[model samples]
Target chain A: MGRTTFHTDPVEALAGVADGDTVLVGGFGMAGMPVRLVDALIDVGAKGLTIVSNNAGNGETGLAALLKAGRVAKVICSFPRQADSYVFDGLYRAGEVELEVVPQGNLAERMRAAGAGIGAFYTPTGVGTLLAEGKEQRTIDGRDHVLEMPIRGDWALIAAQAADPMGNLVYRKTARNFGPVMATAAATTVVEVRETVDLGAMDPEAVVTPGIFVDRVVTS
Target chain B: MTAQQGLPLDVSGAAEHPEPLDRAGLAARVARDVPAYAYVNLGIGQPTTVADHLDPAQGVVLHTENGMLGMGRAAHDDEVDPDLINAGKVPVVEPPGASYFHHADSFAMMRGGHLDVCVLGAFQVSAAGDLANWHTGAPDAIPAVGGAMDLAIGAKQVFVMMSLFAKDGSPKIVPSLTYPATGLACVDRVFTDLGVFAVDHERGRVVLLEAYGTTAADLAERLTGA
Candidate 1:
């Protein structure tokens, strides 16, 4: 079989993921959340996962359900508390899971760094806040900057609007948030698309994630 | 605090105590100041309503921190799309020239000084323009900073919208922030129901630009101890 497979079932697409893998799950709130892939990963029952995402979980679905199942050991995200993020909030307060809070921009940039092979970079975000504690600080022309390291992922689970058979992906509207960057940061990026388009159907210039970044895609 | 007493109080246009600006009134005031051909980001809660007051001809583009620019009005009934939403998670539509990018690129636009202005709701802003809005530092509270830190320091001009006082009548504008800080010396202006104050971080002062129900001298004296 070719390296990139378009699976009919997301479970099969996620079959190789093992326990304790650092997974980067895309989405802000429910938008662009790979629910099928998350559900499959849930059924796969891999535990101690380190999930990097925007929100920890919402309501009783997607990442929340994954958190509810006790599969995640640590959550490295920008924002974890929300009106319906009870699952993660509960688990976090109970001291059952570790939490690492990062500024939203830093969260995205760190992953972009991992993908682009940047060793480390100084960022103005979170320079003096509690989040910047213990990090090296530099004054560049009198402006404060903090050293931030790259965040790599073993698996990136993302959602897309459409995908071509060769694996180039495009997402709908604001749902494209971290999907493009996450795809490049992971060793294996798994995507779930609503539909698969023929190769020529997708505009070459419009492809948000090139085929090289994608490892698997399941039509959900 | 040193410049408070000597500051000139403009009493030329005074009603002694004109009625304070309501939500719609405050939004209108902030909208008037949005420069033409500017890219703006409105924070969640009170700041979001400022979008409604914006005029299209002014070439003011709305930037939703979630990953959109040139954001349009809210989606109703048939127009709602789960994938198309604003920073507040409310369904929205894209304008004709709307653009979308990934989170990194989106945030880069903010931190890189590409945005013209960003309106936000604050818990407190000191005379030195120190911002304290992200967290209360309450032990039991679940902290969620979201994009507050990024937007606070990123925008070219940071305007804060809030009631003049807390629910208990305590002033939200203080000499120093007791609440945890979001960013240091980042806020440029404070738009309140009572008045508008400009923060001069260099001189460490809060100057009254306009007053609603209060006069400059009275608010200034209060600012010293408030």
Candidate 2:
């Protein structure tokens, strides 16, 4: 059993988390992501965090805040674009922020696996070369597979269009990236929704993440 | 490695069949200069051509930021495997013992300083080794920067390939840059249609390393001011 609490300040609720935590963020390139929460964490000076996002947003907008603050230690991402003020590049060259670049398709699957409670899965993603190094390789039906592990987070910070008292979430447009998976993967899921709705007010199928997977709900 | 026979220049006009050089020759030239066993990231466009000319017999290992190792050049139509593609989303072939990975983990490798060399295409590269290839804001332009930034900063050595001059005879390599920099002072070597040059860091000048048939003065004339 777990205890629940509420706060008017999202930062106060998030401040309970410690440093060096792995945080799964929901959003696609500047889409539906927890921008405010990310900024709050940066303002609080959280360091050594392993950040998982689709793409670090344009400079001064999304994950770039945390990146510019030099609080992120490692980044697990799909595409590393430069128009983002080259902040990622500067960190990379300085050996400050470690990076793991993944293919877009595999990134989705890895997040999906975490949400499914699978600890590890095998695929043909990386089998022959350096990616295969130190990884378990198996042949399935005359084909080779490279073993990959699911990525879960201590907390999943997500942004949603609406949420209820019980934490049912609905995303708007492109802001839904990896949100559902991240919601299920983390032990505690914290969300920042645009609108707070009464429980049972929303339709069933429209809710992407159920209240049970989510531990806390923060509305902005 | 064998020397490529130069293409005979057209005396009549600037247009000639095949432009006197095949893709293989270009690939070979790019591959010849890269040191063996160096972790290499091949950029999209012409830079991918190096994979074809790589003498794997020389022990060069190619890496795709998309989580592929032991990568080879673009596969022939008959050998094409749709599932296997480079970052550019073009079908490619994987050499023996090639491995795939979660895209995130692949980026980790690059950010971890494991890559030794990154070869990329460029719209312009200053004598100071600054690169700007992603966007010109031109109409019909596919606005993108892709992994060029990561590759530029992550790799130990940055190599650029491009024409010395734009179509309008405007020099792409200049004393200083006009466009946004991809990576500041990160480029180590450059290969152009005219020749190869390296950064003379302290002097802020480009040092001529090789010229196909052009002189250092002519190269400097185009790359630097009088």
Alpha-carbon lDDT, every model: 0.88, 0.67
Model 1's chain B yields a TM-score of 0.91
Worst 10 residues of 2 chain A by lDDT: A123-132
Superposed by TM-score, candidate 1 places the C-alpha of residue B58 at a distance from the truth, in angstroms, of 1.6
Docking class of 1: medium
TM-score of each: 0.95, 0.51
Say which docking band candidate 2 falls in: incorrect
Question: Residues B33-137, candidate 1, lDDT per residue (tens digit)?
Answer: 899989999999899999889887898999998899999999999999999999899999987999999999999999999999999998988877888888889
TM-score of chain B of each: 0.91, 0.82
- Fraction of true contacts retained by every candidate, in order, equals 0.75, 0.03
